[model samples]
Target: MEQHYITVPISRDNPQDVFTVNTKYRVIRRVGSGAYGTVCSAFDQQHQRFCAIKKMHRVFEKELVTKRCIREMKLLQLFSNHPRIIQLFDMDIVYGLDEVYLIFGCMDASLHDVIHSQQPLDTVHAQWFIYQTLSGLKYIHSANVVHRDLKPANILVNKDCDIRICDFGMARAFSQTNSMPYLTEYVTTRWYRAPEIMINSHNYSKAIDIWSAGCVFGEILGRKVLFQGRDHVDQLYKILGVLGLPNDISFWDPSEAVSAHIKNLCTTDGLPPPTEPVDFNAFFPSATPEAIELLKRLLHLDPAKRITAEEALKHPFVQPFSDSVEESLVPPYVDPQQYYIFEDVHNNSALKSMAIQEIEFFKHRMSQQELSESLLTNNTDGTITTAKRSHTAAVATTMRHFDSSSSWQL
Candidate 1:
């Protein structure tokens, strides 16, 4: 096979952080790093635009990490057609280094950055942002995929106010069966986690994502984190502090053990449970009544009673921006059980084998996309190629091309 990518050397401040990437991308700067990968902004010479390149180093070091890497790649491919979700452009693997690289559409900044910056967000901005977030969530939930991590940092935005939900490494696809597999409580960030998840509910539903979206909505409105907790115990208290204890514990349908656990935390220490929920109008005095009402529905303590993404889109706060036609449309759905194939593979060698296959699959898809774009650009007859143009339109939608006049700074 002909090599589609080449290793390029770039100067770095930290020697240990140096990386090898495709020559098609010129590293602009290191953007962020985490336990599993390092992300950098790069100029895609081939596409004539900027893109975010994430390099996952030493992927084979742990089985769990390798699984996550593969899962993210697969999920990105499945949702490539959705405009609101981040799109994966290309991917490659280092031959001998056991490293992986994923290229995705670039954005200006994360919602976290926007909230913390001096930028002022008006009510319209809040409504649009939350609407886009829920829009993406509705499509994702339609496919039965749960984006377990939905914090502000995972949501990327541009100056145009376009929202693209990213970071699906922690996401999971649920089987269609009535009985759900045991999920880990360590899924979402502590502050954004649903009350059921914090209490260690064995079988949580897609409602957990709604809770996280609610937290993000509140943060955007308040210009700060809605629930800031020192630890898990403190996190629960923080949620209860604002929402107050439910009038009836059974409303939440907690397991017997979980019920006792909650009771113990409330009574064992000198801390007393909140007697009344905080007044939304006073807490977020700037928020309109419609925004307050939507926030309450999203942040409901009981997952069962919480508003779903589909219903939230129709809420009064965002109704003006919500397109009834778009809301009714459904995207392509992928069976959740398709990802279960990886669960049986235990050894690092087997995991690596699967990873290589996925990389090749994405490479083929990228090449086909490039070929279609090449044909569209090279065609001379504008009137005669209308059919061809329509045929290739879907695959030809690449990252937004930037010209010399475009501003790259956030």
Candidate 2:
């Protein structure tokens, strides 16, 4: 194997002014910044490719941020090979250093950029993008990972119109069966959030992501956000105004969790009342029948009635691109719970120590070793060694080969 390094030119007196990596990647310039940290476009000398590196800021300042960052790394690695999911090339974690930088494949632009640019996407392009989203969501759902945040901003696209889902900081794996854990706390963006999440319903399912995806699809078609709300309350009202009110509330919650909000907003007296449902055709008058049907199913008020990724992929609008929706090379199941990096939201020294340990574990799993010539020079059997692209691939292969049990150890 060849060892690659990125070199930096610096004056003798100003050695610290130049940017450099372990000799594999060189930072070109800052691209953007997010809640996690600053992102930069970099050159990968090893692979002769350009990549993006995110330097995580204030990772240990809050336990929730730390946990979400760690989970993002884990899930990114877990779904690295998926065609529509972002590829994490490398993770840089220096010993005793408080900061961590994540290296990823560079993308042409994000769906947010496209939507906000006021670009008009034809029906073919809109259907293609939506199909790709559903394809990726199917794979993520197959792994039991719920991308709680599935908005245009989190979805990246290339010049070829290829899509990749990014920002898995809020993603989590849950039971596929009906016994899902109660995740009552807020999770997604205001406009793209599902109705179940809007009302603080505890029975959130994978379908919440479908709702967000539907919103993204609608934005692509309408060239604007389908439902623009100022707040969570307004957001729910916008959804109800479009989809109208559902007759049955039992699926949402029998205890009046969702209905309570409607009662407070729509009624003069604090009591439930029958509201006429709006016709889907009126809202999406410009959309084709197939597109309208798919959007309606995705934006259903009831999560249970919402279309699953698999079902959405089969819809007439997206089915034409079935050939493009290839099966992803998903890795074995590694319980994210086992790698709980944070205890609670606090800035305790112990939490900082734990955060460092989690990062160290990632570095250890990602680093490869040199092979000795003496061990293989006399071997007659033909064999070759390949460098693993990212830590998730390496860790997943290791876990699958050594043990498939829920408890994973390096």
Candidate 3:
């Protein structure tokens, strides 16, 4: 290791620390701990802002996993200037070794975490997630980087609800030519993998992402992973039961896939779509008809006929629903030091225990005004009032706190 890569002057309050970067990047605290390495909240000394620092374990000189991480890093570096994909900031390499540290956007919660939580995200939240997923996927495809490991866990929703795709440990770049060889990867989290991938198609396209997006959309609608298959074949059946099988023998060759019968039973001489429209209303009771129809189109069995990310963005469902997306996707307006359910004075108090006449009451009678405004406004406007957004976010946040920290006491 180089003795003097670089250093910034700071008080040496602790001298026994193993990490001696002493750069502008001050580790705020560890936010996430994983097998690969720990992700910590950090302050970007150079940029003077908060960031997430990912320090991946540098296993060997040429380990496959390390290479995979590098490949993802390359993609991030290539697309670092974009808005949709998670931004990769300055890289930190251990002075004398091959190890690297990454600083990126620090976020609030992962989509997977929320999906598993008892308090399911409502329609407004779901739609916003889907919209951002499409937008971010569009950005990745534009750069020819197909996010192979797409799932709720890798998608982060920041404090203000900005969606950022993270954990590119399995992401591969696809160019004009195919980079993801079909039989090569059965790598994604099974519930969100594509059918072609399930059957081991070696030369797939960006359509793999389309399939995964369909899964994500369903998860949003159903408030759980739509097809939680314990294995590969089970996942295929879950999808087939919903979308039916593709009839076209031309696209799906039995020679290529494990089950030729899957194609034969679903298709005739030509490619056939699903026998019935997916029961979208069953999954999303409150979703607009347009949104349901859009989901149907996106979940098509034939990848060729699937809706492209850009096309999905242009769909009637998305355009009409964009106002809600903009509102939710924008950085959340939660005050940095704001209370959720419990105020500053009631820091250690229980939400339910607090009386209606708590210490800090919002002035101007915002609740009565909000209720009256809600009644007068038409449903078409569809904007969740600031008061409402604040209330819901607060409720969700506090519920999470209570669920995890119920044992806490003053």
Candidate 4:
């Protein structure tokens, strides 16, 4: 893949130089879509890299998408050269619409798919993955940015057991203290939301992000979401019930820097708050002490008391591998998380764009190792992979019907 840095804009009158491969990169297919744009994975012939391109559509105002485009560009720029975080290489205006192509490293699969496949991942793997995520969060938080959304869908894994955090469309940044509807308040999916936010505690903090991160950590170990709720109230109840209810102190205080959101949100009907630390190991019996300790620190009800990202990276679970973990070092590498979208193919455009790259990559692999899309066959060593394609990384997988034993098959 090409490692290039460029900040250029395509002209409305430029005649669409890169879109045409026979446009340039030979359209592969569509990937997926969000509110305003489509993400397509296209192969850049000239660049010789697998690129995910965001082509702005006319759905929202041109000005709005332009602003979002710039916002994403700026956010990516803030984390420039950050390896764990996705890298933004270029943003431009193409064919009368604003377009941005961000570059991220490749990965074999995602932590989510692996877990959701119903295979049990060991605590060591779970700990290591969470630690990498926290390290990325530490970097982003140090820069005063908040990842609004944290979910299994956003976590990816590389061949070397490295984890990467991805997606910043809903991310926010604060140079000074502030309140919520954070430039991106929609911090995460329903299942992983924090308590304060769920209870409508308008005055939120980076701790919310940390809490969601903890939720991701839980998902890794339990092979499922620990708190799976359908709505904000249900979500809060799930967290509070599992972690137990909070007292007045756990709620917001007007004495602090927040607006009157707390008082306004909470009712006169007060509830008892527990003083004891919740025993998480009881719930996650298979988890290591290290993982439980980190989760407690992350899921603290009080935003002020929750563990900071930098502090989290210092924890033993993550610290041991901090120096060598690929996800901890940003920039010039792919964020495994960015590509873990399970072939959703951002709005179909990215899939279309990436087809040529996939084909080329497939051929390249075939030539080198005679690779095929077949599953395990009979082998002399009793392990099909041991005889061929031994280089393939395996995770605890339950994806295949019969291989209930493989952790990564999912």
Candidate 5:
């Protein structure tokens, strides 16, 4: 296939960080990279705005990688209307190529960059950042989805103190039953992982995100990582050192195997005996009392005891910015199953086909949405004619095809 854009090297120093994007997007520079893919900042001539273009390298190399690629795209589409979640503007895929390109609205910086930079962060900044994080999590949880990975690096922020959570590769939607299915244990960076996950607990919940949010909150106040563990064992040890060992394992309801693993580690790994936890007041001396209180609640060792995203919003620390009206929930009309369409398919070719279908679906949806908006604008301006009215009816018919049953299939 004849490609629309030329391949350009990201920089003279890093020759490997090259990007092949559409001609409409003028590649400016590389923004970030990871095991999954590389992201580059580009100016979209057509849209008159900047966008973050991500290229998933060798997407079909492994089944899991392909599934994650498709899953993230679908999840982003499902949450497209959300203000706190990163929006997926467009995507592209060449029939014979191994790479998939995704375009998202560009942000100024990531929370990680802000935390590591020399810029000063006051109590108000911390309050608003945490509030936005929890607000996004609340909506995600309402749909029975778990982010599984929540850290500073995955959060995008701007100079205005606004934030948008990104990277849904590790996200999963649980069934409506009381008990959650066993999930992959390898998730979230070691330092931000919840205690239950680190201990290999049988079933975890959205509280894992709460724990991570707390770690991020603490990092903001102290201007450094709160746990700073070197390895998995050290990570658990650091957490226990600060929170102290749970008085009883049953408090969080760990499985027998997990309980045994914890006991064996404590007895054989030379871990120090449980000691008094650090004093939050002295630890964050400059922080307000309400902030410290909220931090403690968020970092609770027991998942059951952890503060929920909804309750955290109402905490005295963030209550000033909390608006019940703006904290929106996923519409009841959306079916959670649509997000899991590729879950059962293990074939790479089928996964790739579905991924292409997803891109087409979003492209069609975006065009239809644009048409609807244009029609509405013309109608409001009193420029609508008989032919335009018939066009409007045709657009409405197309929009109706976006219901749950419209999901792409093999």
Candidate 6:
């Protein structure tokens, strides 16, 4: 796969130069669609492999949709080589048609599919999957990226149980230099969503991902979603019911009006008060002590106090899978000089133009590949392009992270 980066737009003569999707990739079948766009599997004749092609409908039609597509494209490019993160192969934009196609390395099924199949997972299987999930997230958070949506459905896994975090359309960069983006009132699916996000916390952090991971951790062990809330309000109540409101005074920020809002809603709804707080051991009786301890840290009510991805990787629960003590320790989070702003992708014409520029850059890179030669030869414009592919450094090695039992047959 090419790893080239193109920042400037290239000149094109005829539309055929960039409109080679139909000729380059043979559509296998429609895979799925969501609120964002439609996706399908396609055979890449040049690469001789199956790839998932995400067709983002009406990319340029609305500012919100446009920003979403561009953000996903850029984030994929940034995290392309991470072993546990989905890989981006190529991307194309049909200039005149306003169509955007994002090509990604294909995988068999999602964790959601495995869990929903009602297939039971043993402790080893659950532990390994959780380790890899944290490994991927550790890399992401270390780079100052936040995957707002970390649910079973977004976690793709193959028959071997190797997992890749996918769907970065909702991800954004947040670090010391880059101010954290505003937290959406309610992001991620209700069952997997964090309490802070559900209650519309003004200031949230990477802990959101840890909380969601805890929910997944419990789901895998229990073979059911940990918190099956019907809506945002219920979701908060659900979290409170199990974990109970954090007795730690620092848990709730007084200035954030969401705290009061939650209180009023509970009072207005006339829901009964939470019962005795359920300890982690009772919550996940099958899990070992180390596993339960990690869950407790991850599911903390205070974002400031929650276990970080880096910290979680070194927890005793994951130590059995740790390859090397040094390797398992994820680097501390370092703030980048600047982050790609989602809003800018929509409001700034200069930034929006980067989408086409990246497309052209990718086309120029593909034109140089021996396998891509014939694909571009069909160009009627009688122009040639060439560029060397870029290579991103691989993620540092850690634990084996999986075994034969890792594969989910179901």
Q: How many pairs collide in each candidate, listed in order?
A: 0, 3, 10, 45, 0, 2
Lowest-lDDT window of 10 residues in candidate 2?
A: 401-410
**TM-scores across all candidates?**
0.88, 0.78, 0.67, 0.65, 0.87, 0.78
Tens-digit lDDT string for candidate 5 (265-311): 55256766475688888889989999999999999988888999988
Per-model lDDT:
0.80, 0.71, 0.60, 0.57, 0.80, 0.70
Compose the digit string of candidate 3's lDDT tens values, residues 249-362: 345445645446564433234543465546778768977787788788777767778888878887776563443332222123422112112222222223212321221122
Show the lowest summed lDDT stretch of 10 residues, model 1: 387-396
lDDT of each residue in 35-128, candidate 6, tens digit only: 8776777788868999988877667777767767777877776676677789888888765667788999988778987776645566666766
Task: Please give the RMSD of candidate 2 to the true structure.
Answer: 10.0
| Better candidate by lDDT, 1 or 4 | 1
The sequence of per-residue lDDT tens digits that candidate 2 reaches over residues 286-377 is 77889988988888777877899988888998765675425453456555444343423356577666656665666666553223443555
Local accuracy of candidate 4 as per-residue lDDT tens digits, 106-139:
4444667677765545655675678778877877
State the displacement of the C-alpha of residue 21, model 4, in Å, after optimal TM-score superposition.
7.7
Better of 3 and 4 by TM-score: 3
lDDT of 2 at 193: 88
Residue 189 miss distance in model 2 (angstroms): 0.7
> Which ranges of candidate 1 are over 4 A from the true structure?
4-11, 182-185, 253-257, 264-269, 324-333, 376-410
